[model samples]
Target: MEELFKGVADPVRREILSLLRLQPLNVNQINEHFGDISRQAVSKHLQLLEESGWIKIYQAGRERYGYLNKTAFYSLKEWLDAYLQWGEQSLENDHGVFLEPTAYEKGAPLTHPVMLQAMLSKDKEFDGLFYNAVRTTGIFCKPSCSANPKPDNVTFYLTRDEALKNGYRACKRCKP
Candidate 1:
């Protein structure tokens, strides 16, 4: 947990994590975004992030890429959930793509075909009928989330707990 806190403590690291939330990026591409800073500095930050498990660096051919490891956020998510259970104030996320889904209750699991349809359509009716977890991103979201992850990377869960237990974390955007 201390590591997780340190991982997100830096402004530059937070920005890198935010970027990874959207998509994976190779080291050079990540460095390009921080033109004001030396690449060595960014590399150091990446190393720390990796040690903290917030990001996973891998060599994809000759280019090394960084991927977001959402499971690393699970502790934070649980802490937030505890607050929510205590009737703490909710945050209005401007980047959120789904809102109505939060008002619903979790439903039974649906068929794979049905889940696929809901995913593509972003069907609000199926928001709690099933959870859509993206393996590539290691994040799970409500069916109504507007983000379009590849179908090949998606899996279904009957409940958010089920998804979390399987090593996926709730989507920050959807907050599922």
Candidate 2:
């Protein structure tokens, strides 16, 4: 979210995250490390980090402890990883040969070769079976769509939801 991005954009907040990553520290302990700022400033940074879901703040006796919350960071990593994977083509091997997904990634529904062929030929019969996501255009289309995406620029998804979830929108031409 925009708020989440803005939350970590501050240098002080990012430093707080780095500390939390090591171990949970109480407000006083965290405040001691920053020589340039007042305890109130450190607490403000911690509060913003907690509100953004990057860290958790909990009361233990008289002190409030802050710890890294893996969920937000994990989700962030996965979301960014989706774009990284999409951009990679991730298709090359050291041998200078292009590789298709010979082994379907853990839960993927279709083989790359099969889906790639269907997309290249614009096969109508395979429309619902898979969607071709174009990395360059950030669009996903039904295999039946006339879009002729290059092999290296596309990734296949099993459903519209899968494509949308990965940040690709449906092609207006395909209305997928």
**Top candidate (TM-score):** 2
Q: Which 10-residue span in candidate 2 carries the lowest summed lDDT?
A: 91-100
lDDT of 2: 0.80
Each prediction's TM-score versus the true structure: 0.49, 0.49
Please give, for residues 56-91, the per-residue lDDT of candidate 2 as tens digits.
Answer: 988989989999988888778887764445456643
Each model's Cα RMSD: 19.3, 12.8
Error in Å for residue 70 of model 1? 1.4
**Number of the top-ranking candidate, with lDDT as the measure:** 1
Model 2 Cα shift for residue 29 (angstroms) = 0.8
Q: lDDT of all predictions, in order shown?
A: 0.84, 0.80
lDDT of 1 by residue, 1-176 (tens): 88999999999999999989999999999999999999999999999999999999999789999999878887778866644543434454322223233343455345676678667878777777689999999999998897999999999998889999999999999888
